[model samples]
Target chain A: MKAPDFSYFEAQNIEDAIKYKSEDDEAVILAGGQSLLPALNMRLSSPSCLIDISKINNLNEIKIEGDFINIGALATHSDVMNNDLVHEKLPCLVDILKMVAHAAIRNKGTHGGSIAYGDPAAELPAFAVAMNAEIVLSGLSGQRIVNAKDFYLGLFETDLKSDEILIAIRYPLLDVNQHLIFDEVCRRHGDYAMAGLMAKVELDQSKINNLDLVYFATGDKPNVGQNTAKLVIDDGYDYEKLKKSLASEIDFAGDLNSSSEMKLHLATILINKILNKLER
Target chain B: MSAKNSVNISFSVNGENFDDVTVPTRQHLADYLRSQGLTGTHLGCEQGACGACTIEMDGVAVRSCLVLASQANGSSITTVEGFDDEVMQKVKNNFLKHNAFQCGFCSPGMLMTTKEIISSKKKLSRDEIRSEISGNYCRCTGYQSIVDAIEETINEIN
Candidate 1:
């Protein structure tokens, strides 16, 4: 598998990377290159230039700022899984990370890279949306922050401009009362999830205080179960009604492996299972 | 913005340094290593599914097919041959005792991953060993033997 020819530029800093991208009409930013390289080799995308930002050391720190934990764009999935801050602050995110691809891939794949790729089936993007994490993008114009809900526009697409580079992601620390649960049904262990659900629920002594459900791999983008959430909270956490309401609210076109109706059914099953687990 | 179509890179492989080596920017690390007469790294699936191209980059296992040669410039890499003989001696003995392989296409990559698992020094169960080598596809053997071999090696180490 040979990739199309393209000029490569190793950027020293964020400014140089932005300048290189701004200059080229067909340019792609190289972060971990776990996703982009496979695309390049398969000829799915042909760019005139590749601005490699993997060398910039400044974009590789995982820090905590007050109430939020900041993760650098270049931080690998392995980094997130092993990072003490992520494990202590956001164990749900770490749980999702374990289900991603394989150990070797995670050792090289980056967190922001997967989110920027905007794969609807990817766990991180849906996880980001459920957590309402903030995505940081840097360009020649300076830095701009976009909420995770607004970051993903559609399938394999993001709000990032061509000349912009993703710098870091900011996730608010989980609250004491908040419980996050994630579940995904895939054909194989490492394969992309056929139907995945991640939710952050706040319970006030058995009464649902707040619930946010995000579904992936079943929609064009990560679909927030807003109406379903409202139905559950307003209806006093009725599981049966929630299942039926959720099945009707979320729509997905199944692929070769499963049917459209089956995908929705799997989503409902995953949701019910996760909610039931949370009750304990 | 002065990017080069083919760039010169410097990297160390198997304890040897190769500086000022020019390669196509689009070339992957697996292809580059093969070009340098290091065919131990197999290219099972360039799409990063099959882990036949697994290699050690800066002391961690990574899929070489997904990593570009240019991206690995100035880094230290280790292939199957770079793996120490002392460690592999025990793995090979356990593999033979368990009949770990058949066609041996996935051996080099499997060995590299197995090396990583052993070096981690974690007490691994059979299921955990199976999970660690899940990336490396072995069609010849039913993987039971492979898991047995790895499990026995872990036991020996502990």
Candidate 2:
């Protein structure tokens, strides 16, 4: 299906994008256009105008500042995956990004667009949650930061306002002691996961000190397995106990491809899989 | 087309320049390419799922169906028809030798993706080659021929 007719505006800068967004209530920000264009082509979303922010200068920079790795909103998936800084600072992200869509889509899909799209089945949103990344939103008033966990409201819903644009995301530099492990069950390599896990762990003498278990495609948004994480941290990797606890803690939502039972089963398998990897 | 619906875009397609051409804002790059008689860029699923409409924009492969014609303004596009390089020629020869495609519906996208994989210059294993071209779905030939073709192409180039 073809996209509905709309007006297009190429923003020269962040200010221009914000101004354009503020002027039209039905305006959408066009970043890499990987996700937005598909939605537009399918008519799932039909904005009156698109503020093309792809050409905005410096919005695609991936750099380290202070204690955080700041990924500019325009940074494409390929950009993040292939960056030297990202490879050095957040190597796990490179592995996780390889599983995103495909090479062609990755070349055009922006990190901010993926997060802003807030697909429950996507890897990046859950990654942001596990890493406790800070989302930067710019609007007419000023710029404000939101935690990745709070930024996502529900499936395909985000805290992004109509008049605001996601400018960047800041992920705190991973400590030398910390390790990030990610795994997902996709029928095919590039398809959205049936269920996925992004676990950030800091182990002290092989005991789980800090663990952040974030699951995708199991709930409306990236569901943090807080209770499950607590249980694992408290009791170690006891498969039976953790499985029981996970069943009670995480609420699985069934989609067209997988059932709630299947998601729960897959989530449990992923949890055990990561825990075993940590032990090794 | 009304002024509100149409956008003036200038882009280079297959080394040819199109200046100030008016296209509907909703028209996708694949459709626009086909309209220009570069029908090699096929469209299977308009959504991003099927990579049938994959093409090179600004030197990187992207799904043309997922990119609006307006969004492609000022960019350089290369379809399967655009390849005249030695590597692409070798790749084509390998596909022909291996019978990489059956109906050839997915051939354009497969070729574009194959070109990218070979150009990456990575020492990829058979599994990696399979993973890299996973987006382009070929309903015919069961993909073994495609994989074999890509493997031989890489070996020939190296």
iRMSD values, candidates in order: 1.0, 3.5
- At residue A72, give the lDDT of candidate 1: 95
Query: Model 2, range A72-120, lDDT digits (tens) per residue?
Result: 9889999999899999998999999999999999999999989888988
Residue-level lDDT tens digits of model 2 in B1-158: 11256789899998999999999877888999999899999999898887899999999999999888888889999999998788888888888999887899999999999989988887789999989888998888459999999999888878
Instruction: Write down the C-alpha DockQ for each prediction.
Output: 0.81, 0.61
lDDT tens readout by residue for model 1, A1-280: 6899999999999999998888776888889888888888889999998888889986768999999999999999999999998888988878888899899999999998998888887899999999889999998889999999999887788999877889999999988888889898988788888888998899898777899999988887898888888876876556577667876776686877677777787877876777778877
Q: What DockQ was computed for model 2? A: 0.61
Measured by TM-score, how close is model 2 to the native structure? 0.96
lDDT of each: 0.88, 0.89
Top model number, DockQ: 1
Among all windows of 10 consecutive residues in model 1 chain A, the one with the lowest summed lDDT is: A235-244
State the displacement of the C-alpha of residue B127, model 2, in Å, after optimal TM-score superposition.
1.4
Q: What lDDT score goes with residue A59 in model 2? A: 86
